[model samples]
Every structure is written in structure tokens, then in C-alpha cells.
Target: MPPRPRPRPRVAVVVFPGSNCEQDVAYALNWLGLDSAYVWHGDHSLDGFGAVVLPGGFSYGDYLRCGAIARFSPIMDAVTRFARAGRPVLGICNGFQILAEAHLLPGALLRNAGLKFICRDVALRVEARCDWLDAPTGSVLHLPINHNEGNFVCDSATLDDLRADDRVIVRYCDEEGRTDGVSAPNGALDNIAGITNAARNVFGLMPHPERAVDPTVGGSDGQLVFQSLLQQFTQEVF
Candidate 1:
């Protein structure tokens, strides 16, 4: 018999009651030739999925705080288990907030320094490489960020640890890739736009890479994020 082809990897995109970006994330995954399925927040299992994504949205209408209530969703328990197993997990925008609230990642997102919602394309400087983001160090990517509370803050000790361990994945920057606070849209500490856990399997970012996958609409720099994950999956790294 001929050698059988390996099954394509499938990703689970978790959807909470107020989640609005699940479809966008699924679309981006499909566009990248990966199968994706919506897993409701109430679901208790994450079996048979190669990776998980918590896309951006106002979960529970952002009451109390962004992602505060969503952290208690039944599916989050599964997500926590999956992440602890060294599986890949991605959290974007509001999703990032949920992860922080769940203590999956360090730090909290505060209201924007301007106290206004920001929705626009922003430049990001790739600071480190991992399973999710394979962009070359110092490279710049343009991704859209839409949120009211995107200012990332943490205690000085945590910030120092993240920097010392090279867990800071991306930082807001100028078009030329300068990461000075001058270009930080939400006043995140050290202009951090994204970060990875110590194991580097879990990633969280404030920007929306799914919104920037098509060049005709904006640019395709966001593809790098998904592509890297897919590549890692292909290598059986999960």
C-alpha cells in the first residue's frame, strides 16, 4: 500500500457570548489552508485540536473588565489544560485580557492612556521568535489594533523577568521599526504589543493579525504569525 498522507491540522477558535472575531480568525486559518472550528466558551473539551485561538472581542460585554468574566467560561479550563500540556495557544486583543485574568500569562491590560478606543493599523517590531511568530528579529509588521483597554502593565519585577528571558515577542514601533514610546498607541509598558509565556507555546498580543492577512485590504504581514504556527505543527512540535 502507498504511504498515507498525514491529516491536516485543525485549530479550535474559542467563542464567548460576546466574541465577534471568531469568524475572522476561522477565515484567516482557512485562507492559510488550515482547518478551523468554532468551540463555544461553554465547551469543556479541547481534544483533537492541534492549537487553540482566543480571538478578540468584548466578552461578556467587557463588563467589570475586558475578559474578566470570560475567564470563568467552562472552555477556559480546557484551554488552561491544553496550554499546560505544551500545546499552542494564541490570544488576541480581548483574548489577551482573558489569558491574563486566567493567569496563563503575566500582566494586565489597562484602559488606554488616552481613555479612548483605538482602531487603526500599527507597526510592530518583532523582538523574539517562537512557534507562533517566526518573523526575523527587528522586522516590522503592520497589524490592526481595535480596543478600549490595550495598555499592557505589570509589576516591575515581572517586566524585568519577561525582558530577561526574551519572552517579549513584539513591541509597538515606528514604520522604520523603532520601538520608542513615541509610537506606542496605548502606552503599554516598554511599548509591548505581544508576548509569549516562558515555554513559548502560549502567545498573546493586542494587535489583530487576522485583520491584516490580505494585502488588498491592508497588508499580509500578519500571515507570518499563522504560517509559523502551521509550520511548527507540520514538524510535530506540538
Candidate 2:
């Protein structure tokens, strides 16, 4: 008999109590012909999943701080282990806050410099290549962002290390892909919009890539992010 076809990789989209973007992420993954399943916050295991995504939304009602309460969710333990194993993990917006709170990625997201919620499409320049984002460096991606505290901040030492190691995955940029404070919607330090862990497996960004996958609704630049992930899985690079 001919060799059997490999099963499609399955991504686990963790759903917290107030998470509103889980379905969006699932739809984007399914649109790309990949399998996706929702993992409740109370679940303790992430077995049989090829990747994990913590979608954007208000977790635990954003009490105390964004993601501060969600960090203790029962499923976070599994998510932590999955990340440590070098598996791909992508967190968006509030998801980014959760990753930071869990210490899976460096830095903390502070209130917007203007102290007002911002929701709009912004230009992002890919600063580095990683498992989650394989787009060419300096490429521009326009994605939507909606949050009150999307400003990314880190200690000076960590900032130096991130720059030296090329861990800054993306930065807010102008139409010409020039990064500066003027282009930063939330005043993120160094115009950072996204970053990856030292292993380059865990990626967290404040933009809503899930909301930009379909050209009908908006642009399709967000598809690049998911496409890169699927490529990695197809190559068995996980």
C-alpha cells in the first residue's frame, strides 16, 4: 500500500474565562487547513498538541493586572511545560501579558503611554526570524491591536540582551518600515511590537494577527504568521 498521509498538526487554543479571541484563532488555523482544538483553562494536560496559542482577550476580567490572575490558571502549568520542551507557543495581546506574567517571555506590558485604549491597524516591521515568524527581516505586516496596556517595558539590561541576541521579533514601524517612538501606538520601548524567547520557540506580540488573516475583513498579512507555523510542523521541526 502507498504510505499513509501524515496527520495534520493540531494546535491547542487555550480559553480563559473571559477570553474572546479563541474562536478567532481557531478559525484562522482551520482556514489554513490545520486542525485546532480549544483547551479550557482548567485543563492540566496538553498532550497530543503540536502547538499552543493564548489568544487575545480580558482574562480573569483583567483584575489586579492583565494576565496576573490568568497566570495561575490550571492549564498554565501544561503550557509552561510545553514551552520548555521547545514546542511552538504564540501569545497575542492579552496573551502576551499572560506570557510575561508567567515568565515565559521577558518584559512587562504597562499601560498605554496615553492612558487610553487604542484600537486600530498598525504597521509592524519584522526584526528577526523565528519558528513562529519566518517572514523576511524588515518585511512589513499590518495588523490590528486593541488594548489598554500594550506598552512593552523591560529593564535596561534585558533590553541590551534582547538587542544583542536578535530576540526582538517585530517593532512598530512607519509606512516605510522605519521604527521610532512616533510609530509606536502604545509607546513600547524601542518601538517593540513583538519578541521571542531565548529558544525562539515562544513568541508573544500585542498585535491581533488572528483578526487579519482574511483579506475580506482586512489585509492578509497575518496569514504569514500562521503559514510559517504550519511550515515548521510540516517539516517536523517541532
Candidate 3:
């Protein structure tokens, strides 16, 4: 007999007071026929969700720091617990900053090197086939990024460690997938665009994949990330 199909995993999009991308993420999943729901920041449980997303936008008005205050949200406790269980967790843009702040992932997001908010579609190259990306290495993806503090930074040792462990999942690149300084929009260290934890389950990136999920909007490179999650988790009984 053929292998039995497992139930699709439900995704939860965390929404903080200043999060503006929660609905966009939910819509992206719903548009792709996947199950997803919004979880308020005050909620302390993520019991049934198989995956979680910390979407983009200024949380707590970016007070003190971009994600410094939001890291203490009630839902983050549950998120931290979920991450400890080795489930998939994604952080995009401001969300990436939170992941860094929560220590769920390494490195931190700093102000743009140019000191200006950047909003544009840019080219990216898959550096590793982590849980969030199924694309072949060197494959180019075009995704939109919107933020002022999207520049990623880390100590030299940490950068070396991430490089050694192959945790650098993606890098800003030219349309031809060349990893040159000119292609790096925010002057991120090592042109890093995204990364995954040692376990490869927890992922964070500055670009808004959800915004690029629709063909009508221009690019669909972002869909592969979501599809990879659906394909991976839906195949196993969770």
C-alpha cells in the first residue's frame, strides 16, 4: 500500500503590539492553502502549532531597541519552549532581531550601514539547504526587504563559528548569484542574508519572504521557503 498521508501542520504567526506583518504572513499561508492563525503576544501557549513565525515590523515601536522589549512578550516564553523542542521557527526582518535578542539564534541586527530605511527587491543565493530552504546551493532568489535595522552583525569568532557549522543559509547576491559587496544592500557582515541554528530548525532572515509569495506582487522565490516547511513537516506525524 502507498504511504499514508499525514495531517498538515498548523503554523502560528506571532503578533506583537507593533507588528504589521502578521496578517500578511497569515494571508500568505492561507493563499497557499496552508493552515495558519494569528497568536496574540499575550498568549502564553502555542500547544497545537507545529511551526511558528515572528513576522516583520517595529515591535513596541522599536523602543530601546528593535526587538529588545518585544523579546519579553508572554508568547515568547512559549516560543522559546517550542524552539527547545526542536520544532521549526522562522523570524523575518524585525522578527530576526527578536530571535537574536531572545538568544534563539546568534548575531544581532544593527542599523543600516547607510543610515536609511531600505525598501526594495534584491537577489539572494541559497548557501545551505536548511529546513526553510529546499533550493539547490547557489540558486538565486529575489525577495523584498524593508527595514532600517536589517544589517546583521556578530563578533569575528561567532562569524567564524557560523561559517564553520554551515549555519549561514543564504547571502545577498547579484542577480547572477555573485556574492559581492555591491549586492549586499545593508552592508551585512559577510553579506549574510539569513541563517539557521546549529540544529537547522530555528531560522532567521531580514528579507520578507511573505511579501514575495504572490505572483501578482512580482516574485515567488519566497514560496519555496514556505513550501519546504509544508513538505518537511507534513510528511511526518507530529
TM-score of every prediction relative to native: 0.97, 0.97, 0.96
Alpha-carbon lDDT, every model: 0.92, 0.93, 0.91
Clashes in model 1: which pairs?
Answer: none
Candidate 2 stretches with Cα past 4 Å from truth are none
lDDT of 3 by residue, 1-238 (tens): 9978666879999999999999889988887778998999999999999899999999999999899999999999999999988988999998999999999999899899999999999999899988888899989999999999988999999999999999999899988888865547898999999999988999999998999888898678889989988887768777
Residue range with the least summed lDDT across 10 consecutive positions in model 2: 178-187
**Candidate numbers, best TM-score first, in rank order:** 2, 1, 3
Local accuracy of candidate 2 as per-residue lDDT tens digits, 60-126: 9999999999999999999999999999999999999999999999999999999999999999999
Give candidate 1's error at residue 85 in angstroms.
0.5
Which ten-residue region of model 3 has the weakest summed lDDT?
Answer: 178-187
Q: Model 1, range 34-55, lDDT digits (tens) per residue?
A: 8999999999999999999999
TM-score for candidate 1: 0.97
Residue 49 of model 3: what lDDT?
93
Regions more than 4 Å wrong, model 3: 1-6, 181-183
Number of the candidate with higher lDDT, 1 or 3? 1
